[model samples]
Structure formats: C-alpha cells, structure tokens
Target: MAKSKVEYVCTECGDVSPKWAGQCAACKGWN
Candidate 1:
C-alpha cells in the first residue's frame, strides 16, 4: 500500500505542495 500524505494544491495552476504556504510556488497565487 502507498503511504498517506498531506499536500496543498494550488487552485490556479494545479500545483502540489507538501506543506502550507502563503503563496503558491507554481502560479504565485495567494493562498
């Protein structure tokens, strides 16, 4: 089985992040 993981996805550019941030690294959108 695959390990469970938590991530944050960018709503604008469909970017995935392992941790939460104020801005998206992919689209530079405010989260």
Candidate 2:
C-alpha cells in the first residue's frame, strides 16, 4: 500500500482542518 495524505472533517460543519481541536471551530462542538 502507498501512503496518502489523511484529513479530518467536522461532521456538524464541513470544516476540513489538519488536526482535531477541543471544540470544533466550525461546528463549535466538543468533537
């Protein structure tokens, strides 16, 4: 298998950030 860039998107809002935050800045939730 080859290595690919991974990403995490917020469920509440379509905010694609590099890392996870305590509260989603987009959704404003503890996700």
Clash numbers, per candidate: 0, 0
lDDT by residue (tens digit), candidate 2, 1-31? 9988777788777788787776778778666
Question: Where is model 2 poorest over a 10-residue stretch in terms of lDDT?
Answer: 22-31
Q: Which candidate ranks first by lDDT, i.e. highest? A: 1
State the displacement of the C-alpha of residue 12, model 2, in Å, after optimal TM-score superposition. Answer: 0.4
Candidate 2: deviation at residue 9, Å? 0.4
Q: Estimate the overall C-alpha local distance difference test score of candidate 2.
A: 0.77
Model 2 lDDT at residue 26: 78
Each prediction's TM-score versus the true structure: 0.70, 0.51
Off by over 4 Å in 2: none
> Against the unseen true structure, what C-alpha lDDT does each candidate score?
0.90, 0.77
Model 1 residue 3 distance off true place after TM-score fit, in angstroms: 7.0
Highest TM-score: give the candidate number. 1
